[model samples]
Target: MTEPLVVEFEVDAPRGHAFDTWTARCGLWWPKSHTVSGDPAAITFQPRPGGRIFERAADGTEHDWGEVLDWEPPGRLRYLWHLFFDRSEATEVEITFTEQGGRTLVRIEQTGWDRLGEAGPPRRDKTRQAWTAIGEQFRRACQ
Candidate 1:
């Protein structure tokens, strides 16, 4: 197994609050520029196992993004990330929140990318960078 892309950050909120911000209210903070279709208004997540993480187009057409794999509130969330362009492949993303001294530490690890072959490295790095930016946005939203 290869090394997974890992990104970490600290938010000024408690673990439960941070988790809620990231999972329950992610659409409010996630950068709209990060979406593949270039529409952030259409993106949403339900934050539960088997819940749909998807996007909608102007025509009301919905695109399947992925599904929640695990839903441990206030601490951990694991989900399948499928951008849909590669239907055969699915990436696993795990986000964990830890409370320390009244602050929440957010750590994201993304793996199962070997299927991307030579593109895995760049993809991993890009995802990490995106997550870092998104995390910062989440932190600000929580503040």
Candidate 2:
């Protein structure tokens, strides 16, 4: 099993606000390049355990992104991340928001890459880059 890939950063927003934006307003900040449909018309996270996280295309087609595993407002969220659109090959992701002074510290950790078998490492590398870019967009939105 490979070590989980962790990404951490701070957003210039209150912890509660940052958490709300990340879960409730994901579509506003999620980049097109990171979407399954490439050009999603809408994206949503159901914000509770067992809720759906999905994206809808202009054609009204909805693609499954993941299922919420754990939901704790303003603190943590855990979910299965199926970026390939296949739950059978899904990985786990956990995001936490911590208040520091007046800003929010956001941390994301993704694991279970070994489930991808031999394709894990390369996929992890690519996803690391994608997450880095996506984080930048999230930072902008939080501002």
**Can you write out model 1's per-residue Cα lDDT over 1-143, one digit (the tens) per residue?**
55998888898989999987776676788776765666645676776799888877666777777788899998999988987455567789898999989998888999987988887778788778778878778889988
How does model 1 score by TM-score?
0.88
Q: Give the residue spans of candidate 2 off by over 4 A.
A: none
Error of 2 at 63 (Å): 0.5
Native-to-model Cα distance after best TM-score fit, residue 55 in candidate 1, in Å: 2.2
Residue 69 Cα positional deviation in candidate 2, in Å, after optimal superposition: 0.3
lDDT of 2 by residue, 38-133 (tens): 999989899789999999999999999999999999899999999764798899999999999999999999999998999888888988998898
- RMSD after Cα superposition, model 2: 1.0
**Which 10-residue span in candidate 1 carries the lowest summed lDDT?**
34-43
Question: Whole-model lDDT for model 1 versus the true structure?
Answer: 0.81
lDDT of all predictions = 0.81, 0.91
Off by over 4 Å in 1: none
